[model samples]
Target: MLDRSRTREGHSPAEALRDTVEFARRAEALGYHRFWVSEHHGVPGVAGSAPTVLAAAVAAATSRIRVGTGGVMLPNHRPLVVAEQFGVLESLFPGRIDMGLGRSVGFTGPVRRALGHDKDDADRFEGQLAELLGYFTGANEVPGLPAEGLRVPAFVLATGAGAGIAARHGLPLVIGAVRGEEPMLRAVRDYRAEFRPSPLAAEPYVVVSLSVAVAATAEEAWRLLVPEAWAMAHSRTRGVFPPLRPAAEVLALPMTARERSLFEQSLRGHLFGTPAEIAESLDALVARTGADEVLVTTSTHDRAALLDSYRLLADAAGGR
Candidate 1:
């Protein structure tokens, strides 16, 4: 997990990075197995803009936790660059690195352009994923290969149509369970049925990334997440990026009925409540999808609160 959301007291990016390092150290101390940072372009609230760079920082700070993206949107950059970056990370961290790649742009049009990518870039993601794998396996023969013959574990992040690709590639698959249990279960079943063993993976592996925020009380967790709900609602109507505001402040703003619906739906896959409540939800999620692991993504403004949430979750989940 990554400490992602912006601080209301105006913390600098350097401060945020240091806080993230400390957060990773705490999570490692608590016995979490892996720490994954997300890549989001042009999002004001999320400071994990470059997951690879952040992964390096976290890796350098913590000695044991496996660190990687959860994930890096493959269509946004060249696959070779990604291969080289992860190669270097693998060199530095050895067996404690994992790469999770996704096909979505994770942003809107203007921001995508600023990142040197266009809408149609997603169409080439499958081919690029293959090329990236080849680079890691030292099978790709492109000019000026960086750290050839170095293999790093890689996984694919899939939602709808991309599940088949994960099966075909035989890479560990992570499904976004935002829709519901039915879709996620079906997708997992399909992936397992179609899986072919690869050198990196002897059997099918599934990780479901779900939204969760745990606190001492359900209402407190819900109240803290209202700002996230509001930001998601604003994004559906106004586009990808939105400024952060206090939950109370966001709730006071006028919104249409449809916008309200979108807000609720945006939080559908999330488990927001006390530790016991979140644990029950997570247990159901794991039982339903049969996921090997669950990657949690929390949306909160306060860093300490975010760390506390994970601490509760770790205790509830019976540790690593």
Candidate 2:
């Protein structure tokens, strides 16, 4: 599960962070394999701006579930600093740390300036990623540093040129359920075909990430997606990305034609339905995409229902 630690209406950012730690505990109990937090800067809706720090909190909260970023934007920081941070995390947590990474710079111009990076910085992701990974193998000038020789596993979040980069590096690729399945499928096939064996992985590995909601009825499941759908629409229509609102409140909102269009479009890639329905759909999706793992990133105003959805999904998958 990849949680942004989304702050909902009438909720504090501190509460959102605490909720994420609590969610990790619940996910551990429910037998989920991995629990990942996300990174977002200057977004009023998201509280997980510092993924490594939040990852530490989540890691300390859960004993078994693998904790990591879903991921850290490589463009925003130097590779050495990131390696040092993850090195500290791996040193503390040992085998349970993952280093999921992305190449996004920032959300807007102000954010980019604040982070001391521009969009062009994202183009250097491949080199930065290599340098970051090299530290674990004592590739730096000074050997046996904090990050050197630590075996923290890394996964790449497939953004612009991420598929090809992951292929060359032989790291696990984490991709979204794209607008059309064909484009995503082609990328996966290309990644597998071009895969180069390395210490990280011998064969191509793909993790498909998406929003999933399970409930007794399809309408309820769809309703659980409303908050995020509305946030999507709002972000596109307005420059600001606000916190999540209740499903009922969002449903009653007055939206323009464009807002409605984007809202519906954002809802296309998500999977929400009854347990049996979701199970069959997910199975078919995995078969189609050849996914080694499925990472659910569902968020909703109702925490109880969100957990229930995960519980039903686990039961449907026959639990751990």
Candidate 3:
């Protein structure tokens, strides 16, 4: 499961962090294979700005369930710094750390400027990713500390262009099912066909990350997904991803027709239903994408409802 520790309207950031750690422990107990955190710089809706730091807290909180970055945006920081950070993580957690890298820059121009990244930085992701990976083996050594033989397994947060990079490096690809089914499947197909085996991976591997929620009733599950959807829609229209409002409040909000259209479009990327319905959709999605594993990334305004959604999902996934 992946949690951005999204800031809810009434809850403080500290509470979000606490909820994240608690959620991680519960996920471990529920037999989840891995728990990951995301990085969203300068977004009011997201509290997980430093994924590695949050991941460390998660690792310390749980004995199982591999912890990782849903991704560290490569363009935001130097490869050497990332190497040292993940090196420290691997050193502490040993075999339980994951180095998931992404190509995105900050969401807006000001944020990108703050990170000292240019507009063209997005084009340099492949190079940055290579440098970061090389740091793990000291292949393209960057002096200072020797990170020559560290073993923090790396995964690429595959998107349109990132899929090629992941294939070229032979790292496992973690693609989101939210990107539309056909496009995601095509990306996977291209990734597998072009894959070149390396020491890191013997063959192509795919992990399909899904925005999913489950409950006893389909209506309740859909309600749980509304807060995040509204948050996303608000971000698109307002240019600021504010903290999530209550689902009821979100539903009652007066929006322009265009904003309403965008809201429904955002909701299309997510899956929410009764456990059986979710399981069936998940199975079909997995089969179509040929995903080696599925990563569940879910969030909601209500912590109790969020936890219940995960519990229901766990039961459906046969993790319980």
Q: Mind giving the per-residue lDDT tens digits that candidate 2 earns over 146-264?
A: 88988988999996579999999999999985647777888899999999988989899999988899999999999999999899889998988889999999889888999989889
Per-model C-alpha RMSD: 2.1, 1.2, 1.5
Residue 318 lDDT (model 3): 94
Where model 1 places Cα greater than 4 Å from the true spot, the runs are 2-9, 12-14, 143-146
**If ranked by lDDT, best first, what sequence of candidates would result?**
2, 3, 1
Error of 1 at 187 (Å): 1.2
> Cα lDDT of model 1 overall?
0.79
Instruction: State the lDDT of candidate 3 residue by residue for 1-320, as single tens digits.
Output: 88889999988888888888999999999888889998988888888998989999999998868999989988888899899898888888888999889888889999989998877898888888888888877677365153558877899997779899999998999998556788888899999999999889999999988889888898898888888888888888899998888899999989999889988887887788998999898888777877889888887888888898998888888942
Query: Comparing candidate 2 with candidate 3, which one achieves the higher TM-score?
Result: 2
What's the TM-score of every candidate structure? 0.92, 0.98, 0.96
Q: List the global CA lDDT of all models.
A: 0.79, 0.90, 0.87
Any idea what lDDT model 2 has?
0.90
Candidate 1 weakest ten by summed lDDT: 2-11
Q: Which is superior by lDDT, 2 or 3? A: 2
Q: In model 3, which runs have C-alpha deviations exceeding 4 angstroms?
A: 143-146
Q: Which residue pairs in candidate 2 collide?
A: none
Candidate 2, residue 292: how far the Cα is off, in Å: 0.5
